[model samples]
Target: MRAIIIDDEPHCISSLKYDINLFCPEVEVIDACHNGHEGISSIKKNDPDLVFLDIEMPAMNGLQMLDQLGGNIPFQLVFTTAYDKFAAQAFRLSAVDYLLKPIDTHDLMDAVSRVKLRLNRDVSRQFDNLKYNFGRPFAEQRVAFPHRDGYDFVNVKDIAYCRADGAYTTVTMADGKSTLLSKSLGEVTEMLPVKLFERIHHSTLVNIQFITQFIKRDGGYVVMGDGVKLAVSRSKKDRILSLLGLERW
Candidate 1:
């Protein structure tokens, strides 16, 4: 894929270019721009297949440049940001991928691979969903997870619990449906709102609202509305009790 690298930092541009050439030989660097304006011009001029854009740039930011595109972007975008604050925004924009800097070689390759796969798919819906979410309150926001053929988007309140399955997570919904995610429990936990989801076990994260009853059996366990019993680790018992507003036995 023909691509452009846009970043204000010289070393970052150099490093990404070197990494792309060494690791992702499938992606060709067509142009490297120092700021967003140059990135826009390069993209329009070259009509590249992909673009590696930086979020924080002077004169015009990456999002600003994208906004100028009038939502009919022809090429895929992969955002590079040093700070994690922009990750949510990148996801909101339906970016093909997000690379945290100093970008790892494996991550860079993985991002490129995802970009290639998504190139054939329509990503405009995700962008529209994100735009809708931005206007809603945080509690009304939704989270998307990669499922069987595509992705499953669920409201935070609809999730009953999440269980760790080694490197993957099984998300159980209140309606009794479950979906396996390709992300680890730890990784997925970070994406969830802390106030709504609580870790009752090392491998389990439960939505506080779905707890039907807390049974003091096998040390301690919580019963979900769907009747799934989940054990509470001894270390987490007190914390869970505190969250439940119950007295510790």
Candidate 2:
């Protein structure tokens, strides 16, 4: 499969390239980038099937780059880092594959094998679920909302809607206030109650209870109870209409 290596250290990239070629014969290393910005741009341009990403880099780190990708992240990420203590924890939390620095040949093979297994195992089904739930609503009540500093409790009913602002999500409250969340719209959407919220666009999720009116602009927009207008995607129009109990207008 096509793959790209992203790490700030040139030697790390060189070591990884050698390991992949020697141990994991199937993986073709198409390109290597020095930092997260170039890494992201390369991924967008090359559309590789897998990415070996380093956790820390200048300007944009690996996690930050993933956050910036939003719904458009094309490849399965295999984080390559020297952070030993957090490695096991990260894998446990997200089912993510990773390899440590000063790479071990056996570990490299194991990681590549796992990648192949996951990619071969009904990836289309996984993609389908991912698409349907891309920007699907959040169930705040059940989820422990995360802040940059730490986790906080958020009542599901307190949130009026969610707006994705490049690399961050703005959680608009019912009381006319907004909080910037560190999570992506997709990540936050999974935490929200789908029954109460629905993704109406690539960048927006609205509270079903707070919808004031369905304003059909030249494109389509939702008028909130507070007179705020939010854009809706054409792909989501049918779902939005169904939620509103209205036939096509």
Residue 108 lDDT in candidate 1? 90
> CA RMSD for every model?
3.6, 16.2
Q: Write the per-residue lDDT of candidate 1 for residues 1-249, one digit (tens) a residue.
A: 999999999999999999999999999999999987888789889998888988779888876777777776778778787766433542632323678888999989888988888785655555555555554554677776766666666787788899999999999999999888888999788777777899999999999999989999888999999999999999998888898999999
* Candidate 1 positional error at 132, Å: 5.5
Per-residue lDDT tens digits for candidate 2, residues 107-176, read 8888888788666332222333322332333332223454554344445777888999998899888899
List candidate 1 segments past 4 Å from native. 85-96, 129-140, 163-170, 174-187, 225-228
Q: Scored by CA lDDT, what does every candidate get?
A: 0.81, 0.74
- lDDT at 158 for candidate 2? 77
lDDT of 2 at 30: 98
